[model samples]
Target chain A: MIGIDLVQSTAETLMRKAAIEIPDDYLAGLKTAAAAEDGDLSSFVLEAMLENYAAAKEDSRAMCGDTGCPRWYVKMGNEARIDGGPIALEAALRRATASATSSVPLRPNRVHPLWRTDHDNNVGIGAPEIEYGFEPGGDWIDLVTVHKGGLFGTDYRMLFPSDGIQGIKRFFLDSLVAFGKRGLACQPAIIGIGLGGSKDACMVLGKRAACLRVVGDRNPDAKIAELEDELKDLGNNIGMGAMGFVGKSMVIDCNIEVGYCHTGGMQMSVHAFCLSSRRAVARIYGDGRVAYRTDPQWFTDYQRRETVEWPQAQTKSG
Target chain B: MATGPNKIRLSTNPTDDAIAALQIGDIVYLDGTIYTAREGVYMRVIEDRVDLPLDLPAVSAANFHCSPAATQHDDGSFVLGAVTATASFRFSKWIGRWLAASGAKLIIGKGGMSPEDYRDHFVPNGAIYLTTVGYGTGALLGRGVKQVRELHWKKELGLAQAMWVIEVENFGPFIVESDVAGNSLFERENAKIAANLEAAYEGTKPAVLKRFGETDDRKDEMI
Candidate 1:
């Protein structure tokens, strides 16, 4: 019964906290890229691309205006009960979307799929996807808020490992290379690697990997931590930059989700979420408890802050 | 760097006169007015409004709309996040004509238009178009805005789908798509695509892909 307000407030607070603000580092990087003549600012065809970002920032709104499918991920204690009324969650989510729209002024993104009509807020089937995890003995609830901007269309691509020298990792990387070479038009992509699973599961896992939290700092397992580091270095070396222009940062981050495969195929899928990287998370409690507070200072100036927890770097042997 | 405004007029309709004025780096703050019409509203506007809506103000710097949310500026006077989500190719008929007649001068969005939408409608006209980064919304909105006006589109279509009109203010640092000055970044990007394809076929490829430990030959030991 406790933490009920915390849960709703947490979601509300997180949404408020989730104001789609850009970090200083990103601004600096973009300014640097735009300064380069080779950056294509002079190109006649690329003018729309330039205006899109410029207007988006000048307006202080959702970057892409897509306000993509909203998805919520929650981890909480098993015994705790939500103190609020039964429909509080629905209310909370609605509030979250409203707050996001006003604060970030998200582009009223959600629409009617078949009718092709726009929903007042970006809320629709499978949208603002909510995932839940309940712990056995905890009293508090943790809520994660995610708002993926832009389309979830064909950007997700996959490849099969070619064997011999090529393994699962190679297969994943090759797909990225092919995508880039084909001019798939991706920006601020988070390369998601789905290691092993059935065809359906493998593909889904790969797509979900893009949603994983910041890598290296905190992973459920030691193996995943190691993989995160390797992938980060590998991705950056390719020089994909923020907008896929030539630069040092190809990927904002790389995430991997290893799902046990009951079958034998080494299936790998890669889903890329474009730069308007609009996603936020806040863990909610059954007792209506909430934790992660949005750092008010986060949006305007994103100076890197130290991790709140240090689990002592996992040894190679675990 | 700050730039001064060089005022030019345009219609929502893709007219030869409108497309002629926009240029790269030209600071444009559109005035007068245009109707807000996107995919849903575009179809509805054509079906319902035999003439431009009577209540809406006349749009001079009109930009064709795809979605209300995607409309670059809600109204000429307010500041809204102005953006063109997609191009005009997929839209129903009269999109170009709507722009031409509407007296709007600029079209903002991605991708280059065909000769029909470009040369026949945009280039000969004084209008311009601008494209924006498909990503980079965060960076875009960070700059700030002054006002927002909701355009009057057929709301019955759907709230999100309905194309309403409003105004935008303090719109700055935005790129020009097809400007009145005969500049089109859309064409430039397409040219790069063509070059990338030709180079790719010529056996010339970016060396960066090779630098990564992603090749088949190096997969085993690397992983």
Candidate 2:
């Protein structure tokens, strides 16, 4: 059985890591983007950002102030069982979040909507939103906790059947244009676009895509992958630059996740993550071996390997 | 409009002439004090107009729009983590008159503030909106602020949301985009930059043509 004590300790450790440390891959992506940034002013800004990221890790404080709302994605093994039930699991998670607030010392992000005071010690009504999945055979409980920030791109859109790819593109470009250069959300942003399925599915998938997918990774589907790359290029060409100071490297990556829908409308959710996207994952096995993960591999097995075939070219007469 | 190491220092609150003399695009290194403000603090200063928990003269001279990452102690003490700069667009509501009246001759921030009332609020009052550039939060925090002074609403508003008053010397090498003459670099330069971007994206339009129109069949919508 997976003990609640181990789960609690591991969760707190993971939360601390997510709060202070950035994953290696994400750092590499920022460095790469900064190195490739053109224009004198933009280059200067990118250098500062790199220096800041380096120092934030070394400093006794967090990298950015927004610490944001807490969220978790839980992938549990069918064979493994929690010592207690969901209540116990939630209690452990709550205790872990409180520890982060005081020890890892995350900024208190939770405030009551009406009273606006520390409630449940940063563990309020349904705080630290958790998404769950079940795997067939492992005896470990897998948890990925994200310390996410930014007020933009929280509530997304539902597209009609007529909206099509054009609608999705418009939604993206407009959102970028409206929100870019504001700096409330960091620049060289990584945007995740989710299509199809229910609203919740799209939002969750989009958020997972933003938090889990590394900056340079691409969807296996050729067309969607092409869209991803195209958006990146288009974003760079927009001239918002770093900190919107007239440069070329505004957005580093654009990720897309898709799901099937009932013969109905398409729900598109767009999640834009600032450069400081902080998240950490941990896998605790029933055998008592705990594996901590910095990289979030959200869509590990869902990659599409099937190639697309084109029909015969139309004749001149046609 | 030239770039140079224009190292200059002025009083916390400068005369209208001094403010107007500072041109746009001049890289400035501040050698004085600046306070912090955002949604919470702005409301206190602009709306509530509370008897600012600070020395009026020093605060009026300059301020930063940052909700710094700070940790509060039990006795209402705190230490700054990072002075992460936020965009000034959100502060547009009180960018004019109030800041001018408060004796703020300079405002430092990222992104930028609106330019609608620049002439009315900034020009006659002698103020400028400075943009922090090239430095990340750590660079700004390490080199800029020397001491974290008083924090208002520490126990009340939580850590990051409270009003932070900090001391600094040669705190920044910020760019002056808004001058006392009411000229805004962002307002002036945006059109030119947008034109250049438009030309570039127009060339790449054909590659992702499906994004604009229904070139492909509906059956292949998912594709």
Could you give the CAPRI-style class of model 2?
A: incorrect
Q: Model 1, B44-82: lDDT tens per residue?
A: 556565555544324335553434333332343332333
lDDT of 1 at B215: 45
Q: Estimate each model's TM-score.
A: 0.67, 0.83
Candidate 1 CAPRI category: incorrect
Model 1 residue A155 CA deviation in Å: 4.0
Query: What TM-score does the predicted chain A of each candidate obtain versus native chain A?
Result: 0.67, 0.88
Worst 10 residues of 1 chain B by lDDT: B200-209
- Stretches of candidate 2 off by over 4 Å are A118-121, A153-155, A160-163, A182-184, A262-264, A302-318, B1-23, B26-32, B133-143, B169-173, B197-223
Prediction 1 global C-alpha lDDT: 0.46
Q: Candidate 2 residues A7-95, lDDT tens each?
A: 89999888878877767777787788777776556676676667766776777556665566777888776677888966788889888
Q: After superposition, how far is residue A264 of candidate 2 from its true place, in Å?
A: 4.6
